[model samples]
Target: MFKGLRETIRAYQERDPAARSGVEIFLLYPGVHATIYHKFAHFLYRHRLFFLARFVSQWSRFWTGIEIHPGATIGRRFVIDHGMGVVIGETAEIGDDVLLYQGVTLGGSGKEKGKRHPTIGNNVMIGSGARVLGSFKVGDNSRIAAGAVVVAEMPPNSTAVGVPAQIVKVAGERVNYTKELDQIHTPDPVSLEIQKLTECTRRLEKAMRELEEKRHEDI
Candidate 1:
């Protein structure tokens, strides 16, 4: 139990440098508390104490605002920064060195029985408010952009962004350039419309200039 507590604390330090103080991490951070509580509840779940385990998980969720089912399999060094509104499903499997931001979901889209949740590979970063649904696989070293809704499998070393989540870049290393984590710059619809209008105006001006030049030459 002491070892588990130590490991949980170490996970916090590794993920967030702002967790410099134990008191702050213990009292202020809901993710940290949620993980610690999940450990005990998870143990009970594995031991077939289903009723008690679920009860504790519900209590933790009520207090922490993070919903991580005790049955979910989480690897070592799993980190959730600003983990409010994060939800991990019952059958979800998360790998090592995974980074998740607030409002991330590893959930299902159906009423299936076995393996209904997504399988997240190692060294992956899922951005805030991203929903990775269904029983798909998010390959290793992949990045799921913020507010992206991914309902299918994402290939390894790819960066997915936009609504319905398109893989625009096949980033070999899956680099996270943005400190905000896993967020990619997808052309916003409103911004794209503005750009198109600006380009049309420029083209019209150029056409008018060419027409004036031809008239002057005729004179």
Candidate 2:
């Protein structure tokens, strides 16, 4: 009700520092306006008023590029930064202190029913255009890299990156993805090192197989 509205406005202020006034936020920022309206629409949906809920949600989506389903359960202080084309599925459960950039989709991996959408943990950051699908769990305090397509489950405080997103590093690590929206750079030296290690493993396995054969022949 009024609580959600106040919270949404506060979130806008905390999220976007460039927002000079609440009037500017209400008028100019589509992201803020969209979230505010979605909150009411979602409430209506929970109360079994499906038709009106959908009408308001569709209206909000038309005005803003963000498409938040009324059935989706979003936590307090939820912020959609640059929320164009963000599609949160009906079954998606987003935890508190979560951040999502433009074009992020929390969708289903399969056609089955019952909790098809992804369950995101608290303090997690989903980068722009990242697609985290299925009923997988995204661990708390994790960062999903930009444009990553994650279908597998992520570990707590770990970072998932690349297509079919791999958990590259454990907790207490860092990734430099500054200005990635402008142009993403590949051939990362850090990941390249990991790739080289994988190649070395293959070579070692081949060498071990040859040695084992020679030893067996001698026997």
Candidate 3:
């Protein structure tokens, strides 16, 4: 447990430039506190102490503003940056080295019986305000852009952006998205579509002008 705590603190230091020291993170970081509470709660939950587990989780939520269900499975080095308003549902399973920003939700789409929440793969980065709903698998090394609403499976090494999130980059050279949070500079699919349409319209107009000139010459 001490090893795990050390690893978590190290991860925070590496990922967050603002993080000063391990002692400060242990003492002051809400995310670290939430994670510590979750470990204890999860242990109780696995031992069938459901009520106690829930109580602990609720207390953690009250104090940290991050609600993580005790039944949820979280792997090592899972960092939640600015963790306020982050929600991890009961059935959600998060893999190792995953990073989630503030206001991210791993929630269910409907009133399902089992496996309702999303399964996040290793090394995934979910940006702030992203909603990954339903029982989908967000693959390894994938990046979900800020404010994206993903309802489907994202392939490995991909980047998902926009509302009803679209896979913009897939299976390419790996980019360390967890270290970067520049949401404004990510690819805009809407702008690309508009540019394509404008180019097509220009081509059509040029073709029509040439046809008109040819007809006049024949006359």
Candidate 4:
């Protein structure tokens, strides 16, 4: 238990540059407090103490402003930076070394019965205000950009950006995301589509003008 606590504090220090010391992180960080509360709540839930588990989870939510359902499965060294407004649904499963920024939601799209939430793979980083809805797998080492609404499954070592989140980068080269959070400057699919349409329109107009000139000469 002490080892886990120490590890959690170390993770916070590594991820957050502003973290001054281990004592400060352990005493002051809401994300750390929330994770500790969740461990106890999850234990109670596993023991079939449903009401108690919910009570503990609700208390944690109230205290930390981070809502993590007791039924959600979270792996080791999971970090939530600036964790306020973060929500993890009952069916959501998070793997090891996952990092989440503020206002991220792992939620359901509808009233689905089982597996309504997303299964996040190891080493994934979800940016702030990102909504990952539906029962899909966000593969290992993938990065979900800020405010991106991901409804589909993402493959390993990929980067997803924009609404209805499209995969912009694949397994070609590794990116050190821990160094910085580059939410902006990602490729915009909407802009690309518009450019393609504009080019097509110009080509059509040129062809039409040439055809009219040929017709007049023939007459």
Task: Identify the candidate with maximal lDDT.
Answer: 3
- What lDDT, from 0 to 1, does candidate 2 have? 0.80
**Displacement of the residue 132 alpha carbon in candidate 3, Å:** 0.8
Task: Report per-prediction Cα RMSD to one decimal.
Answer: 4.1, 5.9, 1.5, 2.9
Candidate 1, residues 1-219, lDDT tens digits: the string is 666656666767766767887667767888877887788889999999999999989999999889999899888767788888999999999987788889999999989999999999988889899999999899887888899899989888777777787775564555542343426564354566689999999999999999999999999
TM per candidate comes to 0.78, 0.77, 0.94, 0.87
Score residue 65 of candidate 1 by CA lDDT. 87
lDDT of 4 at 21: 100
lDDT of 2 by residue, 101-134 (tens): 8999999887998889999988777888999999
Ranking by lDDT: 3, 4, 1, 2
Which is better, 2 or 3, measured by lDDT?
A: 3
| Comparison by TM-score, 1 against 3, better one | 3
Compose the digit string of candidate 3's lDDT tens values, residues 92-138: 99999999999999999999889999999998999899999999899
Candidate 4: give its CA RMSD in angstroms.
Answer: 2.9
Task: Tell me the whole-model lDDT of each prediction, alpha carbons only.
Answer: 0.82, 0.80, 0.92, 0.91
The runs of at least 3 residues in candidate 1 whose Cα sits more than 4 Å from the true structure, single-residue gaps closed, are 1-8, 174-219
